[model samples]
Every structure is written in C-alpha cells, then in structure tokens.
Target: MAPPATQFELAQPPNDAISALAFSPDSPSRLLASSWDKNVYLYDTLRNSEEGAHGTLLRTFEHRAPVLDVCFGRDGNEAFSAGMDWQVRRIDLESGEQTTLSKHAAPVRRVVYSKEHSLLISASWDSTLHVHDPTNPSLGPLAIPLPGKPHAIAASPSKLVVAMTSRLVHIYDLSALSASLSSHPDQQQQQPPQPWQQRESSLKFLTRAVAAMPSDAGYATSSIEGRVAVEWFDASAESQARKYAFKCHRTAQPQTDGGGSTATTDVVYPVNALAFHPVHGSTFASGGGDATVALWDAEAKRRMKVYQKFADSVAALAFSPDGRYLAVGVCPGFETGMEDYSGEGRTKIFVRELGENEALPKGKGK
Candidate 1:
C-alpha cells in the first residue's frame, strides 16, 4: 500500500497539547481544534495555497482555561467548547460573539453537538451530562447524573453514548432525552430517564475513547491497554457474537542480551482517540500514545494502513464530512501533566487528503 500523504500542517500550531479536533458537518473543509493553550482555532482547508503553504486560519476563540473539546453548531457558523474552566461556551464564527451556556463543578471532558436534534451534550468529570438547546436557552440546560466520571462520549444522529469509569457504557435515545429534558426543566428535581441500553464494557482497562460508526451499526471503544472493542447496538445473539476486541498500538522490542536475542519486551501505548469515516461505516482510525495513527477495516478485522509517526502522541483524530480529508492532532498524552515534559514540547495538526482509493475497501480501490 502507498503511504498516506499529508496535505498540509498548521503553520503556527498551538503552544500546548491539543485535546480535540472536529470537522464541520456542513462544511467539510472547515476544521476546529481545541487545545491546552486555552484557545480554539478555526481553519479553512480549502483555502488557495502557494506551494508548501499551510491551511488558512480563519479565527481563534479564547477561553479562560484549557479547552478540552469542541463541536460545530448546526449551521457550521458557530461552535461550542468546554474544558478545565468547568464551563461550556458557544462562539459565533461570524460575529465572534461568545456566550456562556453552563458550568460544572468539575472539569468538562467532552462536548458534542447533534445537528438532527439541534442539541449540545457536554460531559464532565462531575459525573453529569448537560444537554443544551441553542435555539431556546430559556428552557435552560438539563443535567443528567451518571454512575461515575465519564471517560469519553460519542454521538450519532439519534443516539448518544457515554463511557464512564467502572466499565459502564450508557446509550441514550436523543429524541427521548430531549423530550424528557423539556418536560422536566428542573433536572435536579426530576428523575433521570433510563438509558436505552446499558452494557458493561468487555475490556479490563479503563475506557479511553469511543467513536460512533456512521451507519449506527455500533460504536467502537478503546482502552488504555492498547486494545479496541467493537460493540453492536443490536442485542441479539448473532449480533452479540460478532462483537470482538483486538490489540493494537503496541510494539515488541528485542532485548540486547548476548543470549541469541530471544528476549523481548512488549510496550503498550494507550489508544487515545478514534474516528470513523463518514462514508465508510466499517472503516475507522485510531490514534495512541505511540505517536502513530492507524486506519482499520473493522469488518475485516485487520488494519488497512498505518500513517507515519508524528512528533508527539496522537491525541485526537477526525474525518471530514465528505471523507476527503483526515485531520490528526499530535500532542503529549494528558495522563502526564502538560508541564512535566522533559524535552521541548511540539503540538501540531495535520490534514491529509484522501483519494477514493485511500478511503475505499481493498477490493473497491482503483
């Protein structure tokens, strides 16, 4: 297979680690990145470029604390972000106006927007999921309590999946959640709605990240042990039997002993991020502390390709809406404090152009 080609790297990258990278649903070329630098940057990937020029930076939204995650609004002209400040804020891309939506007692980890429902879901370390309606703020935000701190969250058009500590994955119906929140404006007083489905993760380690499949076949969850599991939503025996897990993001290093080189040690890197191709439901990408990004064909149960290693750990990954480009955010893993870097830290974002042959299945490739 031919090596993946990087289209361009951000010219002036973030000073700190990047927490999340998102491509606009409406505009595939528009990308947003949140970082520990306490800023969210908007980039236009379609901008005209001279040879070797980077993507154009549209604007930057400043935050009081490190921005952990960001998602674009329905129209693609606005974005919402949350992070270390324990607050969720919305920014207008055109006017540059900012509005505080909600606050949490603990740091917010993830925020995602549902274009179909016009709702914003924010998960925090406080063990609560806040559902916000941008169209009607007067209804206020509804906070749903969770069993434990959320490690990661992934959303589909109609469903929201929250992976919390203790190996719990809660799946909620978006329509049902919106209705329940509307009926009970006081989320504190009313009982939270039961999840559509609740399942214990099959992995032994803590869940690190999740990405919902485009076709809603199921969602893929990754663990810190360098393994990933594909779980189908259908609970039938046949479907359940198809669910499986595999190890990746690891390497075996041979020991330099004089004993004929038989000894080797296995090094495992945490799977930090996952993103599914918008067009091909069975294909997805996983990034890890090993500083490499790999593409997999989950249906075939094998890796299709692995991109070249980046400067630091691959913290986040995203595919454009049209599947024409893949965005990778390279930074140090947050498990270690950002300030504890032993060497000069490098944070970069790369956009790789994907041809039809690159994204399609092996048999379908031109």
Candidate 2:
C-alpha cells in the first residue's frame, strides 16, 4: 500500500478546545483527555466501530472548573487531573471514584506521579508545588515553594522535576524523601519502599542519557520567555538545592505578534513536555508551541527529525512504551485560524511511526 498522506489521526475531541491529554501506560491504544468543557474524556484509539472513525469516548468526568491537565500513573489503573478549579484529583479507572485535594492560588497546570506510585506532584500558577501521598489524604503542609508559579511537572519514582513560568526547572532530590517522610515518630517505620540511592540515580542516568552528562554540568533550565524547561542536576553536587542552575536562551525575546520574532527564532523551541524513547538512551522528543515536534540525539546534541505540519501549538506529547509510536496533542489550524488551546482546543492525537528513512522529502535526485 502507498504510504498514507499522514501517519495517523487517531482521534478528534468532542469539543473544539482540548486542554489536556495522556496515553494509557497499561494499554497505549487507550487515551485520556480533558477540555475547556470542564469534562474528562477517555478514548480507545485502536477501536474501529461503525459508530464513528475517531474512536469512542469511554467516560466523562465533570469538574467544577475546567480541567486543564490530565496524566496517567505508572499503569492505566488511575489518572490524576488538575485544572482551573484550583484542585488536584485522582480517578480510579476501575472504580470511577474521584478524590479532591487542596486548591491552588492559580490554575493547577499539571500533575505527575512519582515512581513509587505513592506520591503525586502538582504544579500550579500558585507558585508552589504540592506533593501529595494519595494513600494518606489527611497529611498537610507538603507544599514546596517555587520562585514563580510553576506550569509543568515531571516525575520518576525517586525524583521530581518542575518547570515554572519563570523559565526555570527545579529538581528535588527524592533520595532523602523517604527519610523525611519517616521523620514523624509514629510513622518512623512506615517509610516509603524505595530510596533514590546512588545505584538508582546511576541507573536513571544510564537509561536517560545516550552519553553521561558532566557531573558538574549542574542542573539548570532553558526557556522562552521563561515558559517551560527541562533540567538535570547531579545528586552529588554540593548545595544540591541551590546548585539547580543549568542554562537558558542566552539571547532571545518574546515575539509579540508572530513576526518571526528574533526571540522565537533564537529559542530552538525548548522542550514543552519531555519523555524518553521507550528504547534508546539519548533519544527523546520535545513538544512545544513552535508547531514543530523535534526529536533529539541527547548525547550528540543533534536534531534527528522535526514534524512541522501540525498547524498549531503542541500541548501534550508522548512516546509509546515500546518506542514504536509517537503521539502528539496539537490544536487544529494554529497557524491560520486555530488559537492555542493550551490543552484546551479541538486537539487531535497524531500517532506517527518511528524509523521512517524518508521522513522528509529528498531534494529531487542526488
């Protein structure tokens, strides 16, 4: 069969503006999305029924305020959501039960689960990060203050990284988190199951970087108008917390009206949402507002491929666990008639197959 015009347009949302999206870990063929309609929707991307071609909406959960972000835990069993309601809630896929947490000063922008499956970290316009142990909902004062309102969060089992509107990303050392959690006299023995030991850190390092980054390279962030960034810190760095400074758009500005602002051109488009390839070290994808999805060769600091036909800003993106597919959440018509949905537009999830030797058209004959 001839190669299709596009990889695949798996699903289109019910409403025009979709705000948040996630692909199920247990079953990648499934997806979850939230929208400006104050509702959460799930879809089976692989489903082919007479009802429609876009797939079916499995369930819809309503929020008092619009649902801005949605994320699935390690498996597909549960999902965490945060939105304009200033709240973070977890929904059990099987039970369909919802649990609400504290309110943020501003909109809760994102939610992610740490590796242990015990804690959920949320970033909000509130300028603070809340770490919650869903197992113990009554615990309080678990908030971590940030220099500015945070807009995104990424977490592994032992580390939590947050991206702020200030164009900085903060890394929290979770190796000692268990120690902190066990501080209470009555909870001394109830420590978290695993710690971020050097072994774990080394494993995370070997798995993430194609080549190991410098030990003193330090963990800082790169951003455009300080919108979002990715950072990595050496756990061995002194003043671990304060040593969280890495890099940025040394010279860039905010293009006010899309006149190809020097700032927009200078930024290489910092990664909006980051994810490791299910298979390769030093292989990752960065999705952002550039209307381009860039694949990176981390070790070589090289560009592998850029998918530029999205026609809008990209909000949520992911690599399938097996690394065979790339899913991007983008608003329709962003360049001409489409406005950025910020996870809130008529977004569609496009599944592109990897390893296409001819991803780009060749320059007529050699």
Candidate 3:
C-alpha cells in the first residue's frame, strides 16, 4: 500500500508576501521563509503532531528592509538572507542573531548555499554576485561582475547558474569560484572571475526563475512568457540537442464584443518559481502566477500532476530534504497595469506530503 496522501496549511504565516521558501537541510520539518515584510520567519513544520498543521512559528528575524530571498547555511542553526537594503545577512536560528555578511550597490535578489563547496553566493539587481566563505569570516566575499542584473540564481553540486536581464545566462564552475575566494581572503578589491560558460537565454522574454538539477547534469529556467527551458552544461552537441522547452501556467478566457461574437483571450502568467526534488532529480515542480503548482518529469518531457489552484499567485516553492514534502508560497502577483500592490491578508503557505511515487519519472514522452 502507498503512504498516506496529505496536504496541510501552516499556522501563523508571514504578514506579507513570501519572497522565498526554503526547507532546512538537517530536517524536513524545519523551514525558513523570507518575506517582503522585512523579516525571516522560522517554523517547525511538525511541532504539533495532532493537528496535521505541519508548522509552528519558532521565531522571526527582522531586517532593515524587505527580505528578498533566503537559504540554509551549512546546518539548521544557520541561515543567510538577501534583502532590499542591499545587504546579505547571516542569521543564527538558535539564538535569533543576525550578522551582515556584505552589501551590494542595489537590492539583493537571491541567496544560495552550496554544501559541497562551502560557499554562499548572493546575486543583486546591481549586476554583481558576491561569494562568501561562511566558515572563514576574516575572509571577505569575492565580488563577480555581470553584464546584466541577475533576477534568479541556483547552485548544483558543481556549478552555479545565474539568470539575468537581457536574456543572458552565465554558468560558473564552483571549483574555480571556491579557489578564487580562498586565494583572495583579505582582498575584496581583487578582479572578478570570468564565467565558465556564457550563453543567451532560450526563452524570448525576461527570465523569471532558475533551478539547478540535483544530479548536476543540467539546469532549468522559466520566463515571464509562461515557458520553461531545460538545458545541460556539458557544452556537447548531443547534450545541447537534448535540451527542450514547454509552456505551462497559461489560461484562455472568452470575451464578448458588441456584435455578440465571442472570442478567446489567451492569458500568459509568469512562471515565478522552479524546484527540483531532492531525491528524484529528474522530476521537478513549477509554480506560477496562475495560482497553481505543477509537477513535471524532465526526462519524459511530461507533466505528472497539477495541484489545485491556490487563493492567489504562487510566488515561491521548495522541496524538503528527503523529498517527502513540497511547500507552496502564495500571494498577490504584480502584473502589468498594477500601480500599487500588497500581499497583506492574502499570503499563505501550504505543505503537501507526497505519496510513494508521486514525483517519480514517467518515461516515454511525445
């Protein structure tokens, strides 16, 4: 028999739109969520066992400005955040202490930790990337300059992928980055490292989110035009040919004109988030402004499942370490004509416990 299929809502969520959701590497129940409310909220997802509400608000780490992204450091007790204050912070979860690691010229967009490399990299809208050594504080971060401002970033076991504006994508070798940071511990003014591979984005519109595959074979990128492209890092013709893209998170609405003739309007929503399952690296999930979450089999080029629509746009997504739970962050989406916006009273977080084969790859696709 399969394990129980369950999904539950967390208690006492963030007061504003969630900018990012991250599950602790040490345990599946421990989660970290950074918000636009200038705080990072920690929760024990399994604190109260009986209620099935897989969370208890443990604490909140407030920042000087709205937090844009967050991720776990080497352990559960440590975390790092990127924020609108143009600073990257290191937070101690156990003591609720915060430390500023570095500052950027513009708002920081994303922060990611590479366990295998022991490096913490943060991307900012100022078109620069900062690489820090969490273990060695005396060493300052090695700054890397980019041609375009980064909108999303992800790290696999060996590679770092940065997606930026103007449809530019850069792939950097982690070993080179680690060595560069170690070589210049005290010199923050040292020259920036060049990208291992630089290529234009596959999608036509602006890039929205990027996620690296756990296996380190390749990475996936989503765009504002409701499309996702999967490509490899091998730089081989065979591997490059295997790369493909597909459309999702789109809907068509019927419109009526004065002549009583009805027409359909195709509405495209941005794919805001992308997450790969920790265990099954070939299978992944995509969340969108369409207010839905979808599971896809990259190897098969098939969609496994699309979860029920949430109350608002799906802004962020994450999978637990064991690949047992998938967390969804929902809030208001910033669209074309919106002059003002807020996630107040509309923000929510939901955790879905996966069944035995819920995210397995289903081979043989068209």
Model 3: what TM-score? 0.95
By TM-score, rank the candidates, best first.
3, 1, 2
Per-prediction backbone clash count: 0, 18, 1
lDDT of 2 by residue, 19-121 (tens): 6666787676777877677878777766755755755667777778878888787678788899998899888877788888667778898777664546677
Q: Write the per-residue lDDT of candidate 1 for residues 205-294, one digit (tens) a residue.
A: 999999998787899999999999998888899999999999999889878778676788889999999999998878999999999999
How much does candidate 2 score in TM-score?
0.70
Question: Global lDDT for candidate 1?
Answer: 0.87
Which is the leading candidate under lDDT? 3
The lDDT of each candidate is 0.87, 0.57, 0.92
The best candidate in terms of TM-score = 3
**Per-model TM against the reference:** 0.94, 0.70, 0.95
Model 3 per-residue lDDT tens digits across residues 1-366: 787779888888888889999999989999999999999999898786465555798999999999999999999999999999999999999998888899999999999999999999999999899999999876878889899999999999999999999999999999999999988745556667889999999999999999999999999999999999999999999999999999999999999999999999889999999999999999999999999999998888989999998989999999999999999999988864566777888899999999988888876232
Candidate with more favorable, higher lDDT: 2 or 3 = 3
Candidates 1 and 3, the one with greater TM-score: 3
